[model samples]
Target: MSDTTQAPAATGSTPASGRPAPRFPLPALIVMACTTFIGIVTETMPAGLLPQIAGGLRVSDGSAGQLVSAYAVGAVLGAIPAVMLTRGARRKPLLCLGLLGFLLANTATALAPDLPVALAVRFVAGAFSGLLWGMLAGYAIRITAPERAGRALAIAMTGIPLALAAGTPLGTWLGTTVGWRWAFAGTALFTAAILAGALIVVPDAPGQHAHTRIPLRKVLRIPGLATILAVVFGWLLAHNLLYTYIAPYLRQEHLDLTPDVALVIFGVAAIGGVWITGTLVDRMLRRLTLASLGLFIVAGVILLAAHGSTPLAILAIILWGLAFGGSATQLQTAAGAATGEHADAAISMVTTAFNLAIFAAGAVGAIIVDGVGAKSLPAVMTILAAVALIGVGFGRRAAFRTGR
Candidate 1:
């Protein structure tokens, strides 16, 4: 764990500084990006398809919603363990296996007879997706230059925003038009295609951690790691609190736009946000973090004060997407900066925090939705956004100390 770890040789030549030599391979990056996109689609597409899934399986909406948590529970229970278990395996095979696993999970969900079976298959499948998520950023960064880690992560992560913007809506339509199961079948097909691409394209680099077990203690001891991760946790938690109920909130509040239209607006804005972060994160990391977190706060307030105005609701969601989407890239970049040499370990921890938040966010959102109502989310988001802002303040100070 003391910086002698081997990087994926297929990435580029290693320098004494331990960063990979600059040799950008755009095609490989694209494959990885596509893989990440499908991974996200598998994780999130269910949110918009809940009603269809419930009707198909003869279950309640609440039970169908558990599909989201089932995946997260898999991530929470399986992501770290998957990475650790596959530590000695070559990078390409591990990733390929993970991708292939998604096809099986989604296909099983598509064919599942009952809710319990769907949840079980989804959990097992989630374990695989979690491995992909937990290891992906590190793999993407490792195969590229160190200074461009942010760019590499940004490109790889573009899939996330795109999934939100396009994948879920398409899944909803597929569920609505054809059948709920087809939506999952569509995901299976998508995952298979990406799996084939990954198998063919990604360089067969030896596993970076083959000789170096992630020193959990060492990573935790890294300066400011905790604060940066807190920002990650709080950011996702805040977003999911309301996002988990976005469709209903929009309908009940009479936002004028259909939920589909709203997601389109939000998705497009999110893509813009991630693009901005990718362009600026490497050059202006701290500044970008503060600004995005601030925008998220303003977005929460916009929702609180929307007062049923169509324009305000749209504006609020746009702002939300811009801030939240960018924040994801910014945070992963910070995680890179925080652990410097221990990128994989640091990213794994970040992934754990991220999915754990996703798991918790839905449950917490459900509580709020059932109790105080979706209207209460704006106030709660403001509070969490404020907390994330403070996390950024303390986190930068923590990351700065690592420079010593």
Candidate 2:
């Protein structure tokens, strides 16, 4: 928890505050991102092996689904407390310890005897994940050149899309090739390697103003933060509503691109989106945001209008990845931009909203899909994307007016 490493001075750059930031080591940044990648891959690994797990443990499909949801639940409920409780801890050591716990959790899941035991193991793993995500942005920024914070953050955040893109297919192959338990065991091994990397490469990062507690009131009082939260919440809700049911929707539409293939296309597009936005965001925050949301709107409309068309469906999937792909970069960058020095709490709040939005959208999307129709989900997404666009406008204006 102590500052085990000294902050290194920024090279060739001074921030708007006229202070030099520590120049983060690249390996450290990479290890940080890898930790997240492993955590999420482990968290979502069960989805690819659900039937096997259910059959192996003698549980129903619905109960198996709880294993996946448990992690999201833990993430949503744990973000704030995790961030706050570890507020003063050294970033590297804390992240290392968290990843270690992650290793244990996955090991536990791999060896769990019953559905109830696996669910509990996953929830604990999810809490560790929540802590890692909530702090990652601030940690990235704190150790990077002040002017290049956005890039540093972008690099660190690449884990989310990467895990989403790779986790299922890889886990499926592993689980299918061997057994369901092997997937968790394999992830535990991967996590252990990343943990070693973290210990060796990552420098300790203590908060700049470690003595001052970032009060929730102060974060809430920040101009346009509410709007940022709104955009993140609404945008995620809109995206997940349809995303959770994408395969069924595709079946209903009779698209040729199988769900798995479509996911690959989406994941690749998202990676492209992240790198592109990371480069442009610091320079054109508001414009790029509008553009990002616009892509989602276009994607939704495409799916709604061209449900049965293969080409358009392909386009829709690509667009979905592009817009939603760079989301972490945009949202976390917005948090850093809005909160300035007090970004940890801001990041935590945004992260909590982000986590909760996943479940909310899933539940709501299920209702919409189950009742009206599958295609209706896209219609709802388009509406939500529009709301998010409006929120971006108001949010930027408010932040400017208040000089945030």
Residue-pair clashes, model 1: 0
Best by TM-score: 2
265-383 per-residue lDDT for model 1 (tens digits) = 88899999988887767667777778888998999999989979999988989999998887666777777777765666677778888887776777888898788777788889889
How much lDDT does candidate 1 score?
Answer: 0.79
Residue 203 Cα positional deviation in candidate 2, in Å, after optimal superposition: 1.4
The per-prediction tally of clashing pairs is 0, 0
Q: State the displacement of the C-alpha of residue 163, model 1, in Å, after optimal TM-score superposition.
A: 0.8
Candidate 1 residue spans exceeding 4 A from truth? 1-21, 209-211, 400-404
lDDT of 2 by residue, 180-235 (tens): 89888998899899999988888777864665775778777888788888888999
User: What is the C-alpha local distance difference test score of each model?
Assistant: 0.79, 0.81
Could you estimate the TM-score for every candidate? Answer: 0.89, 0.92
Clashing pairs in 1: none
The local lDDT score (0 to 100) that residue 147 gets in candidate 2 is 55
